[model samples]
Target: MLAASLAAGGFTADPAQLESPLGYFALYGDCTRLGNVLAALEQLWALRRHDINVKKHPAWYFTQRTADAALRLAERERLDPAEVRSIRVTMEPGGWIR
Candidate 1:
């Protein structure tokens, strides 16, 4: 499901983290992990020239920036909306460069 959703373009990963009663510590911890993953993905792809569209994916304070970046990348790649099945994110929210 995750693969399918990623393949599709412009799907929202709304409500990134903090939407649930998961507590502050856990939320921030999860945000860190999400940031790490996003950084690694960006590095892997040389998104130096890609054009990305951002639509304001929702996020708690912890994951806002990273979520925004992810959305941007997803737009830049022009992911196949039909193929997208899932996204890794918190219930609360939503980037890119190249």
Candidate 2:
């Protein structure tokens, strides 16, 4: 729906529809309703703020630095593939998991 909306080339939209569950999810399954999707995106863009400051928390900072160090070590050492044994990665307790 969003891709179709972009192709239609219009900025106007029905606020009521844009706010509804059906509209937000494109559950109506109609090409004609794409205008509302485009309008919602436009409104989001217009309301966006550039002053936001994002700070990486301790766990994130450590995890990113660890990865960077690992990459640098690999490039500097140039270890042979056959000699490498095993690798393990550990993170802070609350870090992301999959």
Candidate 3:
């Protein structure tokens, strides 16, 4: 419906195109497309304040928290970096990048 509206408004695009890697990145390339997307969202009443827990310094806060937790866990378990084989860090989808 959003795509249909956008197309009627002269901004034709396959909504599923954004699911592709290149199409996903293409979203950030055009201001017109971005504005059209916002407008479509507004028309569909899909735009809202979903992020209730806003942070002032998200990057710094998360990085510091992660470091602190890792250090505490390592100390508690007597983990030696030299003896450690691998370390895995998981992040929420889209959180791995900007």
Among the numbered candidates, top TM-score falls to 3
Identify the superior model by lDDT, candidate 1 or candidate 3: 3
lDDT of 1 by residue, 78-98 (tens): 888688898775443322221
Give me the overall lDDT of model 2: 0.59
Q: What is the C-alpha lDDT of each candidate?
A: 0.55, 0.59, 0.60
TM-score of each: 0.27, 0.30, 0.33
Task: Per model, state how many residue pairs clash.
Answer: 32, 0, 0
Error of model 2, residue 16, in angstroms: 22
Candidate 2 vs 3: which has more TM-score:
3
Model 3: lDDT equals 0.60
Candidate structures ordered by lDDT, highest first: 3, 2, 1
Full ranking by TM-score: 3, 2, 1
Residue 28 error, candidate 3, Å: 27
Query: For model 3, how does the per-residue alpha-carbon lDDT over 1-98 read when each residue is reduced to its tens digit?
Result: 66667878999667757544467536544424556556655653343442224344334444555666778899999999899897777655555453
Task: Specify the highest-lDDT model's number.
Answer: 3
Two-way lDDT contest, 1 vs 2, winner:
2
Q: Which candidate, 1 or 2, would have the higher TM-score against the true structure? A: 2
